[model samples]
Target: MSASTHIAVVGLGYVGLPLAMALAEHYPTIGYDLNEKRIRALRQHQDHTQEVTAEQLKNSALELTNNCQDLVRANVYIMTVPTPVDSNHTPDLSPLLTASEAIGGLLKQGDVVIYESTVYPGATEGICADTLEQASGLKLNQDFYLGYSPERINPGDKVNTLQTIVKVVAGSTSETADFINGIYQKIIPAGTHIAPSIEVAEAAKAIENTQRDINIAFMNELSMMFHEMNIDVLDVIAAASTKWNFLPFKPGLVGGHCIGVDPYYLIHQSQQHGYFPQLITTARRLNENMSSYVSERILKLMALHSKHIVKSRILILGVTFKENCPDLRNTRVVEIKDQLERYHARVDICDPWADSTDLKQEYGIELTQNPRADSYDLVILAVAHDCFKEDAYTPQNFSREDGLVFDLKGLLPKNEVNARL
Candidate 1:
């Protein structure tokens, strides 16, 4: 890894933008994305994702581009494209494949290609490597090399950032692994872990999110059971957490780009290898069903309060997949809105972090700029954004005297909400 080694980072989203920013501090880094609007926004220091601040973007020396021609000058290409699931919950490699083809055409001799996208084992070697080979007219290892270092980016997380988290890097060969590890070690102060092989690194990345999905699914199941028993799951969790080795996982809508989607990638690969992953599959099913479960709970409370189902005006406090972020990818909050709409209930969502245009474009749900006070039949705290936690944003402020309050994330006090899950 030379100081002269120019690096091109493909796909400048949540993972790529921060990473490219960090790398630019040490190397000549170029951030590339296919979306022209995204490149324009990055240049103007306006990140709709809100993962990178305007000050950081304006100060960084990193080059931002939407044209593929701008990437040919780079000596090392690191792909951070998204690996999402399709409608059938299968691994959709279109983005990864397309990125590979684009990067492949720009590959030069001795120029290494490393993938930071989450994928099943062998995807780098089997799918991406082959695509690179075909597009570049070069053979793997002989002409150029390949590497895999899965991205561990948590959106809206300020503490554990790209430089703080330990990076896992693997390559097609030992030399390639060391070269890639050395490059990442330059920016990652927390250091890098060189996996034995690319497949192990891929497997590790896939399971990291799958494990969280499974654990959260267990908590979700307990929440459902405790609901039936008229017990508070959070109380039981609090008591059990007193133990020396208890895993403290809270139950809520498990939605995001990673946990909600990664399990299906592992499930797809496992089934391809002739092994049906029952536990992983079931965990995903349970987590996916949480939105409907919450919707049912809200309707039940509405009925118990003698409120009409069809004519009720319900307000959801948040819509982003997680708190303090504008990332709406795979957010299960829409499921609740959809289910509530089935009963002809008017659903209005408000999230300070979310982009109104994105919400309207992606989910077809208009973002309510100002939610009226004391104007709802029910109020649900959906994502628990920091803005929603202030003393001014209580359930009583939004709901009428007899109106119900449902706390999905359990952020509200026990006495404040009529029900929680």
Candidate 2:
């Protein structure tokens, strides 16, 4: 917790970057990543992720590095690398393993290695510890300690930041847990909750997103059923809200790093333990299919309006996963575009928050930050980025007269929008 302690944060993305920046306020931090571009940008005080601003980066005491040898300067190592899935939706552990090996090379006696990425219950101890032991030639629990502090970073949220949100910390041992909790307590003004063990912290993190995914999946199913019955899902939800205890979860495309993918990690781990994760898997499937369903609904709405379907030029407003953010790792908005393309519709995407290269690399689709509003026959507001709602970005000079405007996430006025999901 002291400024004398040099900390190493591996994989400087959404979760790790913010954490490193926060820790840098009191500790000399090393922000390490394998990506040279990210390291270069960080050194230049230009974070493309936008989680940390240029001025904030300039003020930070965090040193950016790519080489594993550079991490030897720090004793407290925290891993925040990705835990993405394979094309088959299976948990891919390659990134985690590679990070563990990298950190292990710089391991010193009495150093603590903490994991912040979402994983199965025993992943921190089983996979990472084993890799560390093999790579560093250090015995577990004796030579070095392990800890888990699962990240709870909501991408677009400005209110619940690293300093404000309560951090959950746990460790391989009680002493380790206290040390880890003390470190996080320095920056986390909302305080910390020390779990019983590292596995409990892992389980706690996975369940947080899993619960949200299931709630949204139920709403998505209700949305589909209500659509068939010619009832607006939002309207029904509003009516249902008259009851005191009604949960007001809305229906939309479930995407991004946490909600769209974390449940699968739990499901895979559960299955590995000889138990099927029924409700969790069911919710994942239902939420995963929402993009295609949304695309079809758009087509049906076009047909209902007697608008041209195949050759019509469609403009998608936002491409990022969530509103007001730029992190586009596993956005499901691309799925809607894919489904629409199958119907022979020429869809032009525009997201002020997303980078064109990320959109192309992740989904094989091109996104224009400056879209020609005149050519769009239909404008589908997929993500409610703050720019889209502003008068300057609304493009009043364009086809507001001759096009159908479909607000999918209900970010705009109901009277102005033609339809909503």
Candidate 3:
């Protein structure tokens, strides 16, 4: 870590913005994004993702740019671009590849390129390295170096930030790994774990989310099973959690950038190697189907209340993938809305954190600014955002006498809600 190290962080989204800010504290850091609007917003200290506050952005020395010409000043380029899954649930490496090629053209001798995007094992060394070599006409390790440090950003989480979380670093070689580790250790208080290889670091990050997805999927399956037996899944979890070893995973729509999407990356890589993963595949399927399951359950509850589904008004409490976050990427809540709408139910969504315009554009559903009082046949608390937990947004205030309240996250009082999943 030298004071002269000019680092460029590509892609200023949830992961990159914070990392760039942290790196700027110790080095000359440039936050680069292809989106000109995002760069303009960052210049005005307006982070729509809300990962970095206006105050933090204003006070930081991180340079914001959308142009690739500015990237030549940075010898070390850390890519924080997204590695999302395609419509077929296959690993979409377009973002990663685009960033790699862009950085390759700007590479200098002895320069380092560290990836913070979540990808399957061997992606960095295989796909990214090859792309860099071809684009730059520079041999790996001889002209430039590669590193892998998968991001662990939790959207809406104020705690466990980039500075506090342990960073795992790996590289094309031990010297490259050491260089990457040293750079991250300067800012990360929890320190860095230098992995044996880049592939191990990639595998570790992929499995971290896959494990949680599997656990949550199991809970979702249990919720379905227990619902048939007239049992509350949260209550069962609470009792089971009494055991010291019991994992306290709850049932809900498993969605978000990581837990929902990362598993498929691993599944794709595993299948590429001539082995189909049963448990991982099953977990993904179960979690993916949870939204439809919840929709059917809501319809059943409405029917039990003698309410017609065709014309019923349903108020959905949250639309974001997770609670207390404005990140609308890969949200499974849309599936619930789609399924409910298939029955011709009128679905009105409200999320204090989500952007109204973005929601409408992305999901084609208008966001209700304020949910009307005592006006719906059913209310579904899909995301447990802090705003929804307040006394002002109670379920009783939004539902009629015979209205059914379905608590997807089990945040509501058991006695207050009609049912929970």
Candidate 4:
């Protein structure tokens, strides 16, 4: 492994931004994104995503560029682009492939192309490696090298960061694997786990999220069952968690770049290999319909409160996928809103973390800048953003005195909520 390495991080979103900044400390790093606006904001030391702070951007030596030509100087390219699912819930690798093809065009004989995106096993060598070969006319492990270092970025989490999380590195060849390990070991203080092979690396990443999805799905199904029995699922979880072997997985909408989507990638690949993957596939379906379940439960609460669904005012606290993060890739909160709207209810979204512009653009959702006090007939705390958990922002302040207060995140007091899932 050479000390003088130029690393180019492709697709500077939540994962790419922090990784690029961290890599800059040890190597000459450049962060590239196709979005011109993102590059402009980053250059101004204003990270709209809030992944990187202003001071960090100001102090970091990472080069930010949207131009493909600027990546020509780099010998190591890391693909950090998203691998979201299509409308039909199929794995859409267009973003990953597009970034791969672009980086492939600039590949040199000894240059390495590392993928940090979450994908099914063998995607790097079987799909992306093929793309690199087609574009650059480079032979894998001979002319150019390939590495798989699946990203372990947890958005909105102050803990378990790039430096803290144990990184998994793998490559097409053993030598290339060691080189990739050395590159990541520079910044990852928690150290690295060198996987035996790239397929294992990819499978490791897929399982990381798929396992979470399965556990969460179990919790979600249990919540639904407990709800029908008129027993609070959280209370059940609390009692169960007293045991040493119990897994404390909470029930909620499973949507994001990883947990909600990554399992589908595994499911897709599993199906392609002639295995149905019944358990994982069932878990995905159950999790995907949680928004609908939550919405139906909210409407049931409204009916109990004598509030008519038609033309009713409903306020949703938090629009982003998760709390304290604005990276709304496949948030199911919008599905809840849409389901309510179908019944002619007027839904108002309020999230301090999400950008109003992004809300309107990405999902055609308009953020209620000023939610009227005690005006809504129903209030749903869809996302437990830290600010929403405060005393000042409680249900009594937003919903009508007798309005239904549905707490999906179990953040509000049991007495304060009409129902919690």
Candidate 5:
């Protein structure tokens, strides 16, 4: 049988919003989120994540709702919630569990629930399924079914949209698998890859980001080594690019929902299966320390400029993890601010993309939306956001007469900037 006509997409953030918008082209889709404020904003064609443009939201036939009762009509429910870590760095499955419970309460017989949240293997079968069964009194693979379609949504990435990227879908049963693939194939122009089972699909999804994380971690380590040798990492990468086999992953702070966080899911699963992934764990550690490393280097740069490291005014150019995107989840840029504050350095953060209230609430770091130019002793481009990179070309007055300039992403030419990581 083909997929159902009604679909419900839970957690309307970066991932779900785009998917829901695309699916709405073919089905009567309900874009649901618990946040009423967000739903209201979406109804008025405002996307807080900025993934969906106003025109797209207004033109789409999708219904945005905050009520769980409103989703009872959807036969296909997709969960696309954020899977962040706790303060101790352990995976926090609370968001996933909460979303599952919300769906479970509205789940009807014969309904199929799919998950796009990144999790360790068995999460769909174990935690989510259990919640569904308890909430709806439905038996998995009997009264209802479950599927796993890992989200490839790159927040702030304009090139890879829902239709552009190939989606990986797997179901609890063969019939369900085909049905899910058929629905996705209609919208995702890149098509779908049906895995052998849901577990394989989950494993495949986790590794996609894990592999990138490991690759970037290698580049990050190389950046540290090159910095010690007084070599520009980006220049070395440019030289290496002449070789066909050389990977083009550059070194910078590995943040965002996927690269910085998804590896832990693989780590958790690997450990559960009685195997420790040494290389993956080591790469994660290396990437995690890069923010602090950048902070230390900037302090040393201040010392070289005949300025005292302590009690110096330093301005952080970008707070968002990636360039041109406002997403701040698991952002390592905060580490630089925290480290600078420890040394009694006045750290002023300015990111045109970041929401000042959210930054203040999450990191306890107040943001200056527009700090005056060239008013500080040091300026560190922690994030290579397009706004900051553009700011590099136009000189600022925030820095002292002979200020220390540290370009973390090597965004500017060698002669234009002082140092790079």
Candidate 6:
């Protein structure tokens, strides 16, 4: 079955690009994204995301395209579209639905449409299934089949990659499930686990991030409690990590495509079924307010140093959502900058990994490449990128004499920084 199968990975961003590259090693595969510029860049071995290197892109046989008609030849269509939240943090399924609607028109008998996008339970079986069926004029399970294999792609993570992570797959029918599992097995050396139903697979993906969000929320709560007691949260975390069975989750701004947004999908789905999850709701609220919390903490530190808030010079080191990555989706650092700016503080953000155009367009804030030494009233190390490592660079050098420096990620030398979260 694998030898004759042709694969088309739709929405080729971070997830689809890697998956298509891996699948191309074993099967005939083409990657399609709507962005023509991105397609042109990928074809020339230039990936702005930096998830895949120039050498890897240049060597891979994965065909890249922006035209939808190019996807009609593949028997397997994997949806790696982004499933983000709106301004209100509600699940935005427009990207998912639009991709599904497009793929449905090209569906043929015995074709399998597998979703790699993260969504709430029953989303693939209910919403996406209906969309495909309506557009294709075919009955699911009787004509075309559906599958769900949630993508486990970690942006900027090189160690636990696509082939290393275990894949969870499910299908509308038993034979379909087995077929999907086998196909993923060839690409994933860590192997695949076949779920009993599509809903179970979808729900598994939702909670994987929700669990991390709740755990990090607990850590954030601890950071707040320890702050009130005049204790450092990183010191406390270091001590607690010595235990045999402790889960080592640090406290900081939780943002990105998965942890920041996946929980809301489950929360929205649960509410539809008349079940309001208290723990999940509280965690989401607390994580969302971390920006305000960090902003207030910085202001308090500035006040203690006899510095006024208005027209104060501030430098924010690293603005990307996470360290060592250019992905800026739902970054909480912007919120921190906004909260501080409301008090008339001038905040200059510098991130080597992020694009200057994207940072300015997303937040209307310009990116500073080379910050002058000892020129700022205060400095905040928000993202722990490799360039700003304590061994490589000094964040204190950016702060003026007697100025305060706060290490949000606990990456700086403890003695150099005044406080840490």
Query: Which candidate, 5 or 6, has the higher TM-score?
Result: 6
lDDT (10s digit) by residue, model 5, range 116-224? 9998888889888999999888899988999899999888888987889998999999998988998899999998999998889888888999999899999989988
Better of 2 and 6 by lDDT: 6
RMSD of 2: 1.9
Which lDDT tens digits does candidate 3 get at residues 1-421? 2336899999989999999999999999998999998999889989999998899999999998999889999989999998899889999999889889888888888888999999999999998999999889998989889999999989889997888899999999999898888899999999999999999999999999999999999999999999999988899999999999999999888888999999999999999999999999999999988888998898888888788999789999988999888989989888888888888989999888899988988878889988899999999999999778787687778998878898988887898898898
Alpha-carbon local distance difference test for all models: 0.91, 0.87, 0.91, 0.90, 0.85, 0.91
For model 5, which pairs clash? 323-385, 373-397, 373-398, 374-397, 374-398, 374-399, 375-397, 375-398, 375-399, 376-398
TM-score for all models, in order of appearance: 0.98, 0.95, 0.98, 0.98, 0.96, 0.98
Give RMSD to native, each candidate: 1.1, 1.9, 1.2, 1.1, 1.6, 1.3
Instruction: Show model 1 residue runs off by greater than 4 Å.
Output: 1-3
- lDDT, model 3: 0.91
Q: Runs in model 4 with CA error above 4 Å?
A: 1-3
What does the lDDT read for residue 253 in candidate 6?
Answer: 96
Give lDDT tens digits, candidate 2, residues 175-220: 8899999899999999999999888999999999999999999999
Clashing pairs in 3: none
Checking candidate 4 for backbone clashes, the offending pairs are none
Model 6: runs farther than 4 Å from truth?
Answer: 1-3, 390-392
lDDT of 5: 0.85
